[model samples]
Target: MLAPFLIMLREGLEAALIVGIIAGYLRQTGRGHWLPAVWIGIFLAVALSLFTGAAIQLLATGFPQKAQELFEALIGLLAVAVLVGMVFWMRRVARSIRTELHASVDAALAGRDGAAWALIFMVFLATAREGLESVFFLLAIFQQSPSAAAPLGALLGLLAAVAAGWAIYAGALRLDLRRFFRWTGVFILFVAAGLLAGSLRALHEAGLWNSLQQVVFDLGRVLPESSPFGTVLSGLLGYREAPTLGEVIVYIVFLAITVPLFLRPQPAARLGRVTDV
Candidate 1:
């Protein structure tokens, strides 16, 4: 539940921020007439995202047991990939995102021929990327834990993100976005590592992976995952009471590879202050 909540919060805020930037830019440049078209693009993108998620859910319900396991494994792997890529991409682009967005907006409006369509397409692509990423991550989370709490938490997170976006746009709230993203990036890496380990477990269940089946240790009697605190840990950090050798190895290796690179120093760039247009 907590995992889904945080993931959705981050993903929803990203989409909201992108839309806000475009809208702010349009307003600043006195191209406010294009705002309607931007909203249209956002609506279409959102509709597509919802439809895609529902269709996938319906399709998965018909799968047999092993096939379902395979599908879950695939979704988990895809989610991990998408999540990691998004984190790194955001980290790399954060410094110049506003400038790049402004440039894109200018280019969209520069042409008299189908300018509205161009802007609409640009906004659609941006929002849809975030939406699709959320869908896969949500699906993977749901597959791992089939409970009402996960969806409820996700809905709440999205609502909070909407509120945050509006507050930021309205200049009612100030945020330290640099620190926010940095800390959240680290949290997300841990989530992805857990997802990766869970994917391996899913693959084994699907008979696609059979090696490294040895149990590293059994914590079932001491700290069973079914316990309340254990459940929270399981949801947040992918804690398994009787984790296998492969799961532990993969989890550690993923963090070992990603955490340092993410934390390493890079060229100093300002991503702290959002453009107030």
Candidate 2:
């Protein structure tokens, strides 16, 4: 529950920030009349996300149990991929996203090939990537944890992001976006590690991978997933009372490989942070 909440909050806030920046820049440049095109882009992006997520869900419902397991595994993989990509991409672009976005906006508005359509497409493309990333991650979580709390947490996270974005746009909030994104990127790596383990388990269930089926250890007697606290851990961290050897290996390997990559700040970001100090 907490995992999904944070995931949506961070990702949604990123998207919101992008849109806010674009809109703010447009207004500052005295091109406020073009704002409607931005809104249209946002609407279309939302529609695309909804349509894509729904179609994927609908398609998965027709699969057999084995196929469903495979599907879950595939979705988990994709979610992890997108999550990792977003984290690093943001890291690389955080310092210059504003400049790049401003340039794009300028070009779009100055273009002769339908400026409105260009602006709309630009915003839609940007926002839609975040939306689809959220959708894939949400699907992975929803599949792993079936409780209503999953969706509820996601809704609250999105609402919080919207409020935060609005506050930032209104100049009421002065967030240190670098620290925020850096910490969340670390957290997301952990989340993706869990998902990777969960994906391995799903593949095993689907009979695609059969090696290392031995249980590493059983903690069911001391902390069963049915317990309230255990349920929370299970939902948030992919806690398993008796995980298989393959699952354990996958989880450990993911963290070992990804954590350092996440922690190692880009030289430019490090310099910017230092200069800010």
**RMSD to true structure for each model, in Å:** 1.7, 1.9
Q: Model 2: per-residue lDDT, tens digit, 14-72?
A: 99899998999999989999999999999999999999999999999999999999999
TM-score of 2: 0.96
Per-residue alpha-carbon lDDT of model 1 for 1-277, expressed as tens digits?
8888888888888888899999998999898989998998899899999999999999999999999999999999999999999889888878778888899889988999999999999999989999999999999988887788889989998998899889988889778777777788899999999889999999999999999999999999999999998888888888999999999999999999999999887765543333322
Lowest summed lDDT over 10 consecutive residues: which window, candidate 2?
Answer: 268-277
Q: Estimate each model's TM-score.
A: 0.96, 0.96
Any idea what lDDT model 1 has? 0.89
Candidate 2 stretches with Cα past 4 Å from truth are 268-270, 273-277
Candidate 1 clashing pairs, residues 3+ apart or interchain: none
TM-score of 1: 0.96
Flag regions of model 1 displaced more than 4 Å: 268-277
lDDT of 2: 0.89
